[model samples]
Target: MAKIAYILLCHKDPDAIISQAEQLTAAGDCMAIHFDARANAPDYVRIRSALKDNPNVTFAAKRIKCGWGEWSLVQATLNALQAAVAAFPRATHFYMLSGDCMAIKTAEYTHRFLDENDKDFIECHDFFESNWIKTGMKEDRLIYRHYFNERTQARRFYTSYELQKRFGLTRDIPEDLQVMIGSQWWCLRRRTIEMILDLLRQRRDVIQFFSTTWIPDETFFQTLVRHLIPKTEIENRTPTFLMFSDYGMPVTFYNDHYDMLLGQDYLFARKISPSAHDLKERLGVLYASEGVDFPISGEGRSLHAFLTGRGRVGRRFTQRFWEAGNTLGPERELFLIVCKKWHVAKRLVDQIALETDIPCVEYLFNEQETPLPDLGGIETTLTKRSRHRRSVVRMLFEYFGKDRLVLCLDPANLDVIEDFCGDTAKTRVLEIECEYSDDYLIGHARRVGLAGENSPSETVARLLPPIRNDLAHESELIRGAGIDGYQRIREAADRAENEAAITEFLGVDADKAQAVMRLDYLFSD
Candidate 1:
């Protein structure tokens, strides 16, 4: 029996939580739930009643009044972890989950996989440089003082932005520890969970710092684990399946997403809407397809080895994308799009190129000064560098002419992207809907700039504006033309093109189109 304790941080839908708990509960595995104190008292009672028969089930004695993007969220998780450890002392592995999350893999298979590989599955990356913050508020989260309101249940955030404007107070970042952030969900070993708790106790300053951080839940555990654990013991991968839309909200899975859900070889999938009754039924049917004891034995280990080996091979195959080779392009009047999710954007660009017979090249922004790929046809420029703003802007100035088109996939890059394409009337923009697949993990796109020899020193020197504060430089080009005006121009351009080409190739309507304009705070330096 594989001793696993699943900690569920539940807020609403007692029925759903109970249902999921029942499905996950087995002879060897136990469950510990920490319901938000703000939740209905009756619902909490009902959930407790529902789990009355389950001997292995436990609930946190001290419930936390959890709030989104607040310190309380982290506290709730920590409470659940403590409860789970106390309840299931014999457990080897601990999984942090939410009430909405459903187990995609059967208990037997999940146990087998984790037992075979003793590695910890936790995603950790340098916070400030990560794609996690679509807004340039990475500094705001790190330096600001954020408080959770009890009466209003609101998150009161005091950032350097507002302070600078009103009182001229400069930002104060924690100098002792570096903040690391990733997906809130993670699976870890028993020792790790205990070590985390111990570290939290010792590191009072870290705790105090994070208490005021925007989304401490995502950063707290990740930072501790990264700071304490060896690289070999940690795997930069979360086991849960979470689908997020382009807007960065948890995508509610419908019947159409059933196939994608089934395809994932994951232990769980999160934020499944309670309203998706049909979807829930389908998921139940799919999960039951394989019996609990669908004998894997040595097959599971072999499969794991095969997958890991294949991944290594794939990395080596794509090494050309990372290597510093030769400069390829200075394409004539080209269309450039800057995106974080390269693979997702690649498919759309390829389709557009195929349909229009126009030469398009994806200059992958990275930290390394890799020689650009051969830009004869549709080419991909990949590098491992972090500061791609300077390189990307330089590429636009050098390679693309005035009669070019540049569409930035991520609005975060628009600060620099708009600097080039804003006033250029000769440039045209085409709006496209690119559905990012969760399977394709962000590659070098999430590159963290370390103080190393591989730094883009020359590029930075030439660009003048530092990557960190580039968003601060107000773009008069964008301001004067107006966001609405730019949208009108893009819409007109899209309408003039073949309707089929616009719709089929770009995945957007030409008639009622809009430029992918982000909110003001997203670009605030």
Candidate 2:
């Protein structure tokens, strides 16, 4: 068996770390851990005691006093890596990981994947050229020097940068070195590790230089590897998958993210907190199921597809809109729903928003008092009419660009949405109809309290067809089941009013039951 060495950098949640180590450790493989020196003494003791019996697990002798975005982080990683290599000399590959990370694939599969792939697996890109941090924004970490603030225990101030500006103090890196940045976690071959260690001994200045740089843990190894190794020897990928929030922090996984995690191609996921114990337990159960393998190789366009297969109705619906919204694609889409009053389609809008990364906005034309749907903490943005038209349009174009799908929910507000989106070829108009002459439709609509002087059904039907014809070049018409549709939507909404009822009616996990209810409008259509 080919031995794999794991270097885990830990600070908190010692029990979680022990559990993660237990999952990954094998007879030949070893897990070398580096707990932050600043961590509580009790935590350190607990971690040591828990893993004391495991011969494959060893704690680093030299623990760095680690701080966020500081040189100390790089030090801690270096200590862990050196210790891992020293302890497991026969180890074929060295895998860097965080304490909070959990393997998505089985240990056997992970080992097989490492054995099959010859190239080093490290997420890398030129810091200057790539927008790895986020879309359209250049990273400032490379351009500026980040000095660690000992008092704050973080990189909150740039003391060196301030002094450099005032005193014109500058230190230039060697012209031969190219700056590279990426995720701190990686997997390196034994040869690669030896080469890295050799470089460290030969060029002491490289360490001195990167030690002062901002978030050097992300940049140091990448710069060294790119500088030393052939392009073909490196694969610019990491086995660990992390979802980052808008603010550039890793989005913590919870029970709600269980399905999402299973869908990803990566072997590991990070920052699985104590609150996510339920999700962790569920994943353990899932792994015990037959036919499951590591690296989860199969034919499907999405993670959702891989896990659930292509035939399930819910998966089909999610995949359809995900494709429509260009999920995990280069071209991101914004679904703009224009309305004067909250329509049933708002539920669909919210569903699409939750099920994908696409930004979905509901622009209420003149209804400033309209209540924004409680997204329950989904990052969907809802804008009222308080902002100026030009400002809002500019903002939309700035963020989502001209590539958008504009759904004209109310024909009366079509002009408003069009003006905001600046109607382009990327824009697709959609009209929804709700009217029916059938008595069942009328009676159900009245019984559900959706009928008025001008029923939602009649108003939508009267206003929609003309607009659909006008934008027929780039639009689709979605007709509801009149009163029957409203009745179904109301039923779902009533059940979804409470958490337990939603779970019972939708027959989905508690986290997704509400979302499933909101998607009732889509089913009714």
Candidate 3:
């Protein structure tokens, strides 16, 4: 029999933790609860009472207050693991999980998978810059250098500076090491856990140093594992499915987000929620009554249960029209236009030009100076002016027929883009429906091979030769319309030279030199 433990640090959402516990127990797994010391003891007692029926569950003796970047979280985890190991001595492996996390696979499957790997599945996400450390402020207390004693500080500074300056820590580190952020959950073999505890015991100074600083949960595991075992012994991926979104925490995990989960190349659909209830019902009905093998519609996709009966007309139309039309195909070169208030759009456009090789344009309508209207019926002068400006901008895009393939990132302005181009063939127009934080957007772009090194202007200029050739017959007409074609040619050459210089400075080869040379050839003509 395989034994697994869940160390839950319940702060605000005890119910959520309890829900996960119920699921884990149902899968015939043991769980251990570790309520934070900062939590109300009375509430903790009540929570403990609620789980009294479960013999596997037990409250930990030691409790710690966890804060961001602080050692409290690590201490709590270490304490929990110690208690769990003592309680479940015969257990083969120990798994760590968070309260907010939902399991996408059964405990049996996870246990078997871990046993097969014979390795510790702890993610070591490497980050080059330590700028995130500076942001560790709480209640006006600066915690960036929190746990550093004089000797440790000297060692850390020497190591960090050497890594950053001489070795170029950011660039030299492997992608896995550079982005060593684990899922805050891991499964470790009994031997590995023992080794970690033994290391902690021997290196009291290092452990004590970590205790005063940020949660260092990720770093501690990563650094220790690297030291103890050969790099081959570590499994970089985890079995759990983590669903993330550009906006807030993912409310539901779906088929679309499954690929993001690092490991488990072969994953069955599991952990169905209320969001999937409607899809489940439809699948259940199809499987039970119709005796269908796949239970999927003609298009190899099944209808989701959560969306059932919510938008009947819309759903019917989606099933009949949109579903088939929206099938994913081979990747294509895409230009994303995120529409917003005119100023915001302009700023984002500048950033897009600077950061991405893909050409992205921004269209903003509202002026920043304008005051927003109150919820009450009273209309402010600034609000009226802003509304007027938006109307004018909307009219301009409509008249120019530039609405296709343009998305409005602002929720308030999305209707405009949708109203204009929603029914159009998706081949020419695509809408990014999800809200994305800047970090998430950047990360997503990087993951999808969209975050290229070149700026939009540079990429556009490189591709301009083909575009110019296509319009060669109309060049005279274009020139007659007061466009300085010669000036553009000269500018492209100058830009190419400047880019080559910049690449040399950055200690990198110019991969786009041929593309740049093509522009030079166009200019020479």
Candidate 4:
């Protein structure tokens, strides 16, 4: 069998690590585990107990601190890699993983994927050029002088730079050549691992430079690899299917979205959790052949059972919205209902409204006061708690019935609404999926309506043509009206603010008006 070594940097959550190790071992791969020296004794004991029975597992001797932009993790990873290479001299590849990471494919499938790709499996995390330059600490004289001023320090930064400087030529990194910050969890061929080790030894100063810098573990390896082999290697956009969080917590896969991944050509997925159980459950059924049954132990047990239909209660809540009359009308108006803490949701709604013409309404589901806007058509305050529920229900009913589209702008609210409404679709209700943020939810809602798709690019493209046309038309109308038309339209827009008049002037019904208003609101501010 082709030998593969699994290296993991574990702190707590031994069960998760062991569970993942089981998956790796079942794939005919050997496992080498490293516990952060800082981990508590109990945590270390728990880890040992979990892996004691696994014959393929070996623990590392040294421990290191794992910090952001710190070289400790990279140092630990390098240590583990060296040990793995030394012990398993003939191993085909070294697979690095985190304690919280889960394998989406079985070992058989994973190995086959590596074989087929004939490439290292690393996610390419690139920032925009503007954002990239912003991260540089060269302006910090202390760091720059310590690392870049001296020949030894500069040489240590990267041999190429040192050579170029020696030749009296300035180094200009290409714009398209993005800074490669590879995923901490990646798979590398044996030769690649050896080459990296050789490079480290030859350029010890550069390694030291990284050691003193606030660089992340994944970035260290990625930057080194990119600096050494810029042309030969390629990052795998779809290497593995997994979800992982830095904080050791149960992985939650909200909804049945995992089914969406089956169609994609990814080798693995990580960070799967109970929160994501709905999607995992469906995926488990559809792709049972893909080792989806890999036993989920530890804190993930509840989530795993939930996905497998063995949990007491589902993670999602069903919500119901009762409409009073035709609030939306014949044309549908896209409405986003934001119900979050005031400070967070207010800015998000304002930005969305200012940017798009989509109509949005703000609500504080739990607050006693109904939201009232002052001047900009944006809600300014949450008042009147006594009528909160009644007002919210009334507003939702009116918005839906009037043909106004409504999207709940908060995930927690979505959970509540889902629970309250059950699976019934009363007036075209849509749930927005977000990663625990209201901003992401609102962004998704707008993207869905404007783009007819979820991607950022698609949404921008869809909105551009109409926006350009509107601008041109408005410009001509304003010029013709000689400022009077502009003032009249602005006054009309302000008066027609509430759902009815706005729709009438726009030659549309309440729903269409609401949608237009929402689009306007999103773009206006």
Highest lDDT model number: 2
lDDT on C-alpha atoms for all candidate structures: 0.58, 0.59, 0.45, 0.50
Residue-by-residue lDDT tens digits, candidate 2, 75-192: 8777777877787778888888887787766666666777787888887799788877565223445544557653583244646566666875656664678888888889888888
Task: Give the RMSD in angstroms, all C-alphas superposed, for model 4.
Answer: 18.2
Instruction: Rate residue 270 of model 1 by lDDT.
Output: 82
Residue 217 in model 3: lDDT: 74
The worst-scoring run of ten residues by lDDT in candidate 3 lies at: 294-303
lDDT of 3 by residue, 1-525 (tens): 556666666665565556556666665566767888887777777777788887667666788876655677778888888887787676677777665455534455555666677777776544333332233232112123344323335587445434544553322222222233455567777788899899778777666544543446756676566667676988875544443332424345443432222122321233334454443333222212322112111110111221222222221222323223432222322222332223333443344335434333343333333332242322234344233433333333344444322222332333332332333323222211222344443333333333332223232233334323322323332234342111112222365664554233222356643233233222121
Off by over 4 Å in 1: 149-161, 164-176, 282-525
TM per prediction: 0.56, 0.59, 0.44, 0.46
Better of 2 and 3 by TM-score: 2
Q: Is candidate 1 or candidate 3 better by lDDT?
A: 1
lDDT of 1: 0.58
Better of 1 and 4 by TM-score: 1
- List model 4 lDDT by residue over 1-525, tens digit each: 446787888787666665667666765678788888878878788878887887778777677766544567788888888778776666887887766454554555656667766666665555332233233453231132223323334565565444545775443333323445545667777888899999878777666556654455645666556655544465644355543332433345445434333323454456555355455445443322454433221222222332244222335332224322312333444433332223344544454355445445554444424443332322233333222433443455454444432333443343334322322223322211112233443343343332222223433344355434433443333234322101112312442543453343234466555554453433222
